[model samples]
Target: MATPPDWDRNATWGGSNGGAGGSRTPLRQAFSSLSKSSGKKTAQSLSASGSTTPAHPASRSQSPAPEQGDGKPTVASDAGLADDLDNKAKLSLSRQSSVSNKSGAGSAAGRDAGAATAPKGDGEEDTPLQRALKNPYHRPLPGHPGNLTTSQAEALLELTQLLLKDGALHDPEKEPPSYQETQLLRFLRARSFNVEAARTMYLKSEAWKKEFELDRLCEEFIFEEEEAVAACGWRMYFHKVDKLGRPIFIQDLSNLDTTKLLQTTTPERIIKKFAVTLELAVRHRYEACTLSSGRWVDDNMMVVNVEGLGLSTFWTMKDQLQQLLGVLDQNFPELSGRVQIIGAPFMFSAIWSLLKGWLPAATVEKVDIAGSGYLPLILKYVRKEDWPKHLGGECCCSGATATGSDGATPAKGKSDGCLHSDEGPWDKDLVVGASPRPS
Candidate 1:
């Protein structure tokens, strides 16, 4: 066969051959050569002057490219390429070192830049213990409830000791009089001497002395005045009542308009009622039960049967009654029930006033003789003649005599006796006409 133009005559088949027509190399060798030549041509075309461009020094040192033949490129062994990369790296490092040494300022600038970009410290100046102490809401220590340090505890103890000393040394005599006591004394001093202009006599007296006498007399006559005043004060407030003829609401002096009620015609009447009620309560302990059983069994069942309703007891009852009135007003206004009572002076006066103004005459008349102990004393003073009629005279059988079966008159002498005379029609004056005719 004729030899191809591209074929080499002296090419080695599997070894070196003399310049003569020889057997061709292996197919793999031929293909490899061809590829190398092709790669070389491509690389030349891509380069500026039809030559291969040099790679970056670091990259070239790390990995070298394969060699190229006239017609193709050859693949380099991995080991050989690695060695070349190592040599190129050394050269680059040497260059960098030389540059850094020549300009120390450049290296310093780089370091500064790195530092600027790095994270800063948090700038916390307090230590762990200081931070804990400065915390506003720190918890107590393990053994201490208040967590007070020794210095703080000592300071508190000193303050407590000072307070104790002050308290222990405090005395009323050393201090100035209180504002209230001063005012009271001033008022008493001012009212000490009053011109009575009674008949034709003018009297000068200390106000406190007169007040003391008046207060003592009031206690003696009114009986429970002190207790009542202490418990209920001078003024009162009434809240409500039910239809059962019982006080459903009551208050005392503090709640009422003392200036208006005490000065007006109200107080005297209330006092009378209080006195009468107190007397009746004292006298009719067993009688109350009898009356309660006879005519008022059903109604009187709820009535308090204590021996006496003292000022304190009355005040408490009044308060409860007032509360009851309030409840009635809220829950049952249709009953149109009301709370009424005599506070300091007389309960009967309050009842009479209310009856005269708010109720019918018949109701007032009926109320006069209701015989509720508190009312009768006030009725005697207000409507003496009407009192007997309404109250069915003194006795249920014989209505003539002012004396009871025990010969106890109503009010002939002192407070213990009746106020009326005990002389009856049978007890006539001694007749002297027959004696004068015999002489």
Candidate 2:
């Protein structure tokens, strides 16, 4: 991959002067540029990959799912907003190119791509977790014993309401007030139950999409940096889904040439690359699920190999790392369902700890630190055949084992101090600062 040599040349976020953990936007009014469509197009166009392609219609029709447990599609709103939706993105674009797997590398994170989001019905034992996946925002109060925690429920309510107000939605079919059950909960969780913070985060996301005219960007964008990404040795590729049903992503962060990386690609390109990749993956999986089982699941897991990480390597891209985290947190919200960190060096502990502060408490917690038994930890969620032998799996990629991640020293805790339980909304310990217990 020929690295693009103009990465640092792009303008940084003039939007905020705040560094890592600073006072972000004040919700009711987050960023000043809340509406990127407000004529900065020409000014910013010179800075970004400005598309001359006209903007596509931002709103579209929605296919109502069963109003969760009520067994009916949500009733149309008196406001007629029911006709405008799927920032579930259920609405389609006319493009033919499915974001293909020509990505740089692979991991055992693959799943049935055709995975469905089916709710428990007759003969199917319904549990809180199962219900949450079906529709965590659905009613019956989510607190009727074995239901969602007070924090989780309230967080969803606050964040979803914000999205709805901002015109983002996916709601209950037949229910009257299951209200704005948008898929924005992941962002809320990522902020550790901070409604205002979550709201600001999501608003920035919306603003970004609008600025880039993302609906059309996804329909027309093509990420040709595959070779450059591969050259970085930190392969940012998509693999199959995991058995537990999340798209798998693999990146070996240690081997990349940070100097080359910075010299070759701008932050805008990196952000766009990640965004377009995600759009393709989500659309691909959504289609696969709808076609195969008439359902939808949108989330993924990852394998990050830190084999060669050292203080020097860490310092080299420290700024980039900070930028990447901010961009992803604001833009990619809740997409990475889980992460497995392998090939961790003693230096890994420091970097991990630092990075954790930048990430939402929920995201940090879901991070699983692999020990000497890395393969087993991975195999628990991903099958052996799904991964390549380099990672201690039985899978053969393109007839050869791609040497990837290796090595790990177990962190002191069974839960690894990374994330909360994946069980469901029933967890009270789900909140940050809650005591960590065995998984």
Candidate 3:
């Protein structure tokens, strides 16, 4: 075969160690060379074992026994393999730490997040006057106050002027008038009498000028008229009497016809009247009395008597009375002519039936008058004298001591007689004696 080409020889040994016709090195020589080149004690020890070469110390310590059928080395038993895995894990942990440091995040972020979510306070700040306005119980503002705004101030002044004007025509107490009254007069110069007209008309009349100044008189009239309206309304409420002696009627003026009389009339007229009447009624309540005898006896059942009317105030309140009369004519025509205006009384009678028990018999008798119809008679007798003799004496007639025509004495020794006498003992005696004498 002309000796096979050198290529055939190379192929026989897989192109490295020759096989068949290729050149070859002994396995022991190769192992010896590998052991020498490695220079490891374990490799040298394994090389010395020869037979099949003992495991190296590093390999024996790290590698597990290979599986019977598998050709791959066990990863758990491989020393290099475990070291590679550990090195990769350490590299990954280092990278994570570096990233966290660069970002700069911590616990402070949590606190800020909580503060952004927290509720909000009532808004009740206001001035004393403002608060008063909001409160239901606060009193209404007067005609003027320094703190009021310009518009409010103007309105107040106008209202004050109106009230003063009304007072001039109706209020007697505001006699001689005031600066406010003068301003009101100027305002009403054409409609009502003014100071110049009064001077022209009354300056010549000595009597008129002495008794009254025209301007003052006119003002008095206006003031009185206003006061009367107020007084009427007030009396109706405090005395619990209506325009017709019925129960009080506190109705609104909205429904009532107040437009017919004076163009200047207003709801305030009624309100002011009601207020004044209440004050006066309370003051005069104890002094109020009804007339018992006369042409007009019982005619004015609920009418306050003249004694209780306090006439000294009449001149001051004359304008008020006229205004009241005007109001009465406008609203309650029935009482316009019949109602008798009166003044407050000087004294009041306070009677207590229980107190009678404490009084002496004679004193009770002296207080009691004859033929004067019960209470009226007693009052008259008491008015006439300082104190009755019977009140200090043993006579137990109580206040019924007025003598009868007969000589017979009043009944005694009976509780009913001591308290209330059914038939007047004096009456019986008088009747008995008046009877025809036994002929």
All-Cα superposition RMSD per candidate: 56.0, 19.5, 57.0
List lDDT for all candidates, in order. 0.24, 0.43, 0.24
| Regions more than 4 Å wrong, model 3 | 1-235, 238-301, 305-311, 335-439
- Model 2 / residue 65 / CA error / Å: 24
Output the worst ten-in-a-row residue range by lDDT, candidate 2: 105-114
RMSD to native, candidate 2: 19.5
Task: Report the error of model 3 at residue 224, Å.
Answer: 21
Residue 276 alpha-carbon offset, candidate 3, angstroms? 13
TM-score of each: 0.15, 0.54, 0.16
Candidate 1 at residue 22, lDDT? 33
Candidate 2, backbone clash total: 24
Per-residue lDDT tens digits for candidate 3, residues 1-439, read 0111211111111111112332332321221222232233312222121111122221234322232222111112112322332345355334323322333322121111111111110232222112112211111111111112223223334434444453423332221122222222222221122333323322222233234332232222222343233223221211122111111121111111222323445444543443333222211211111000000101111222233222333333445445544433222111111222122134212212332344333223323212212223222212212112222212233344433333233333212121122111011111121111111
Highest-scoring model, lDDT: 2
Query: In model 1, how many backbone clashes occur?
Result: 36
What TM-score does model 2 achieve against the real structure? Answer: 0.54
The numbered model that scores best in TM-score is 2
Question: Per-residue alpha-carbon lDDT of model 2 for 2-92, expressed as tens digits?
Answer: 1123211111111111112322322111111211212333222211221111121221131222223421112222111111212222322
Q: Which whole-number lDDT from 0 to 100 does residue 181 have in model 1? A: 20
* Candidate structures ordered by TM-score, highest first: 2, 3, 1
Which segments of candidate 2 are over 4 A away from where they belong? 1-162, 168-182, 286-296, 371-373, 398-439
